[model samples]
Target: MLLHFISDLIRNPELQRQFSRDPEDTMRRAGLSEPQREALHKGQLEPVMKHLRAELASLELFAVVWVKAVVQVGSTQPGIAAPGSTLALQVLGDFFTTGAFAVVKLEGADLPAVTRSVENPGQRGSVLSCTLDVPANTPMGVYDVVVVNPDGHYGVLPKAFRVE
Candidate 1:
């Protein structure tokens, strides 16, 4: 929840403005805990970094640049796909506004990455949906979903899905 709140702040300018005007009310409305609010109020990143299990430096960078993207699968769609199949993916994140594009990659250890372009992206609110063609020769393993945003910021969601 803390990470999500941070992502919201990074992606939404209105929220940032609101935070600057009234931080306590903004944090309270965001449902942040007392410790989280206090830490943020004091301009401390240590507690946030600890909650994310990330180093301070990297967290700082992420807070400035990256928006968290979550790939939706399993409930309404298959999370696992065979090679050569098309995976219908819905990536939930901010900053995917007008004229934005993303380069989505399926990356696995010791395997060549499978890259797909999300051109003419279909967006509903913060969700961007696209059909990604999994290459026939792709290896069988869990793959991380790496999205490179139009503004050059990128984020990796590890173990997002699997190729059978």
Candidate 2:
């Protein structure tokens, strides 16, 4: 049940918004167990993830970098990108602040990672917007999106986007 809820939360932007607005209520509605609820409420993902790992030994896992942060790729056309394209990113989280730096990278395909830095980022409310330039010579493949904040905290979204 927890696993199902998490899957839904990742795929459904509406559910993500709902969770962001009122996490406790959304978790309750999702019928999460008391312990699961407590763990999530405290932002302690390791215990919950450990339980999930034990439960799904054979299944591939999907994870988010920060429970509170949602990264959206592309402003006009979401998630689709090409080599040499300028990708627009919007990060929604309470942790983002004005003037902080963020490092965005695409890592996968057994290739050297493509990275860009968002220096002196701008934040409005809980949203931070930045752009990353995908190098023209970058290899075409699916890549995991990793974002590192100024405090050295990072989040990873596995297989986040594809380069064609």
Candidate 3:
């Protein structure tokens, strides 16, 4: 399933890097069908939506390949961050220099706005981060990170973040 590939890319940094460098090679290794591979290679989400038999908001939007989750600066470890800390996630996909956005949500509730690091546009991957800014009265629990590119493509990290 496409979600499985996305999950693998999110959990495996090496695979993420490989996907960013050569998507076709990575997809092939993942055992994706020719059509699925072509759809993803072209960044077309309609076929994937159809393949999954689900209706998505952006049928033409491109798909993003999540590669790494570095919760804090200079650390590859993901999850288990305290409130008010910056969390960084790396992804391989298409995004506009302007108009792209991300967010952190818990239980279908949006937590706070995420800031996308404007690294070199030529960089191999996109790094997005957010500060857990839930109010002090907010309950402590796991949260999910969602990214939306300028073209309206969305990718959610399956791994949850634990607040301590």
Candidate 4:
């Protein structure tokens, strides 16, 4: 089925904004869609893998949640990040007043999730940016951006790209 993100986001700013607001608001908004949220729904490896494949940015080894639904990742490449490098994550979606989703974090080996401008939101800069400091000993492999909130709300958006 064809899903128009912009339309859906515009029609339901609150729905989208919730993803970018504080942890409570994010969880509250996520609760509204728990029945259909992919991140929250329990699934198998293949299904979850497939979902991550489609919900991740090949350009980036990872991605970060934007206003509420968008993710601006880097260009995809093999071994793009050298040891002791900083990974950048970005997103652009509906604005969230409480600021870019509370308690936003990334997961990976020897990596630190760093989020700036939390107290002072990105101001809907047509996009949002975050960073995950990769340890000097970070291993090389595929990864997923798992966004979660305090109220048990979470979702993983599509982030795929083509090399050819």
Candidate 5:
């Protein structure tokens, strides 16, 4: 619907900021684009709202952005573990594209895998987020929270806190 509008605008190209948050691309995708998201940090809602408006006007299938950040353990600093946090995945897209969700894995002794089914945070959708729980005896080593999409476009998110 609205996406059809953005498709009409894709001809301009500058509007298409990024596809953003492809679970399958996580393996090949590199580090986070911006570790400290100034937008959220500063609580600047303009850019987000601006994009949302553009997406709505575009009239795409779904006006939302989906994000899945598979945070790595032990990256924030030494002796710091995210015991309690509302882990969020940042997504950005217009009417042309909707967010993606697929498989999520917490690799460890048992290879616990889960299919993260989240709502797209597009202009008309809700943002994706999760809470991480560090295992009591979580080895105190490097662990990975890998996120993948069905189409195979993902990014190995930045490492999380360390257990110390």
Candidate 6:
């Protein structure tokens, strides 16, 4: 029952939105066990993923990354970065770590790079700094950046930035 609820939550963005607003009510209505409900309320994933993995022989989980902003390394404003320069994407999610990676899916190209930390891990909130290397020849247009975690779960920032 918990697995079914989780699957629905993953596939439906509307449900996710509602869950964010009222997690306790959502989990209760979904009939999750006490432990599972508590785990979710605390933003813990290990136990939930363990149960999910057991149900499916193999799985590639798809998750969400709450992107706070996408801007240049030193700029506070969002959007518009130079080609061949580094950009900083501030994101809030539990799946971020040194092991995570990202890809900028531009119209004609894909930029994949390892993520780096701009602030000390224990100092700031759950915000992570991902590096984006906009190619010199990348078309001057908006692009979507997708972040993939070590567990194969991914989240995308649709039309996240523009190259100038």
For each of the candidates, the C-alpha root-mean-square deviation to the true structure, in angstroms, is 11.8, 14.8, 15.2, 15.9, 16.8, 13.8
TM-score per prediction, in order, is 0.40, 0.38, 0.40, 0.33, 0.28, 0.44
Candidate 4 lDDT: 0.38
Candidate 5 worst ten-residue window by lDDT: 70-79
How well is each residue in 46-164 modelled by candidate 3, as lDDT tens digits?
87767555322334322332222222222113556566555554433333234445555677557565554634332234454433444544457776656665545555665455566
Ranking by lDDT: 6, 2, 1, 3, 4, 5
Query: Clashes in model 4: which pairs?
Result: 20-101, 55-157, 55-158, 55-159, 56-159, 57-159, 59-76, 72-90
What tens digits encode model 6's per-residue C-alpha lDDT throughout 1-164?
Answer: 56778779998998899899998888898888787787666777887776656545433222222222222122122456787787766555444444556666776678775567634322224445666677787778776766555555556767775778
Predicted model with the maximum lDDT: 6
Instruction: List model 4 lDDT by residue over 68-94, tens digit each.
Output: 343223222221345566655444332
Best-performing candidate as measured by TM-score = 6
| Model 4 spans with C-alpha error above 4 angstroms | 1-80, 92-112, 118-128, 157-164
Off by over 4 Å in 1: 1-78, 99-125
- Backbone clash pairs for candidate 6 read none
TM-score of 1: 0.40
- Could you tell which candidate, 4 or 6, scores higher by lDDT? 6
Question: CA shift at 80, candidate 6, in angstroms?
Answer: 2.3
Question: In model 1, how large is the Cα lDDT of residue 69?
Answer: 32
Model 1 agreement with the true structure over 19-130: per-residue lDDT tens digits: 9999999999998888778877778677666656542347554744333332222121345778887766665554444333333345433322233333333232344455
Query: Model 5 segments beyond 4 Å from truth?
Result: 1-127
Q: Candidate 1: global Cα-lDDT?
A: 0.57
lDDT of 2 by residue, 1-164 (tens): 67878889988999999999999999999999788888777778798897677646634333333332433322212455688787665544334433433333455333222223233232323444557567788788766655545544545556665778
- Give residue 12's error in model 3 in angstroms: 40
